[model samples]
Target: ILAKFKSKGSLNLHLWTNCDRKSMSPTTFKSQLYTHTGERPFACILCDRKFIQANLLTVHLRMHKMEKLYLCSTCGMSFYSSGALWVPSCNHTGEWPHLCKFCGKKYITSGKLAGYLRCHTGERPYSRLCCDKSFHTKSALNIHMRTHTGEKPFKCKCHKAFSERSNMKVHLRSHDKS
Candidate 1:
């Protein structure tokens, strides 16, 4: 049937079949019927988003109300999932759960491992619109933006403003002389 559809150079096949158990497998036909009918059994009570499986619905519920089931033994920190608790706890005890394949360096979380991998790849995802320069982190990119904008956000008691905090600290020391 699929070969005939492909031969015609078009894929507009109307699959209208009688309820014959011998023609098609019951399990396959049921799944196809569900896809066409949009029959989603599992539904979220909070958002009313439907899922085919109950386990998917249960996982989706976490976004609405996260229940902290796992607790860190070392820091007493609670996490919604076991993986979240395990990663930071490993970092605290100097235990590297995840390792880099390129440099043999270790990281507690997969996210840290991914960021470290970018250093080897030289892939800076954060970029500035004003300049062609890029940074590894958003905070670094934000700080770099102040150089272009000349934005003095930090202020002192003397009403003196500075672009960077370290510059403001240096200015404060001159006041100490008096």
Candidate 2:
């Protein structure tokens, strides 16, 4: 199954057959089924995020609670999950595992490479249901959603809130000038 044909109404593909297990427990079978069927029964209480397993949902809830469970070895930055630490580690390791075929641009991860390719192809894959805005990456769409939710997570000591980190940084510059 190719990435481009994902939404093209299933190319009569039984590619999910590779994951089928006959001797596994019912719980294990259910998890494997959800991977192929896209069924997420475990939902977040705080946000729109859904998970196939309860433990993954628990890890996601930590994000809403601002729980720093994992710490970066290179930097003191904290994250709610161990998986989120990979992006920051790339800065310290200076490793480029993926490369773009269109351009000679180097990326830290395959996900970053996909985003760079989006820029080259001018494809806005992530879209907002609330508005007509579309974004090249899901992160950009997530940031745009803050505007509708009125969520200003980036806060300063003087009690100013900003939807975007760049906006908060600009505001902090004003504080330094005064």
Q: Among these predicted structures, which one has the highest lDDT? A: 2
Local distance difference test values of all predictions, in order:
0.68, 0.76
**Which pairs clash (backbone N, Cα, C closer than 3 Å) in model 2?**
none
Residue-level lDDT tens digits of model 1 in 27-71? 444455554455877777864356655556665676457666788
How well does model 2 score by local distance difference test? 0.76
Per-residue alpha-carbon lDDT of model 2 for 19-125, expressed as tens digits?
Answer: 43442244655676775565899988765567888889998788667898899988999988888888889878887778889978888888879987998999997
Clashes of each: 0, 0
Q: Estimate each model's TM-score.
A: 0.37, 0.54
* Model 1, position 164: C-alpha lDDT score: 74
Weakest ten-residue segment in model 2 by summed lDDT: 1-10
For model 2 the TM-score comes to 0.54
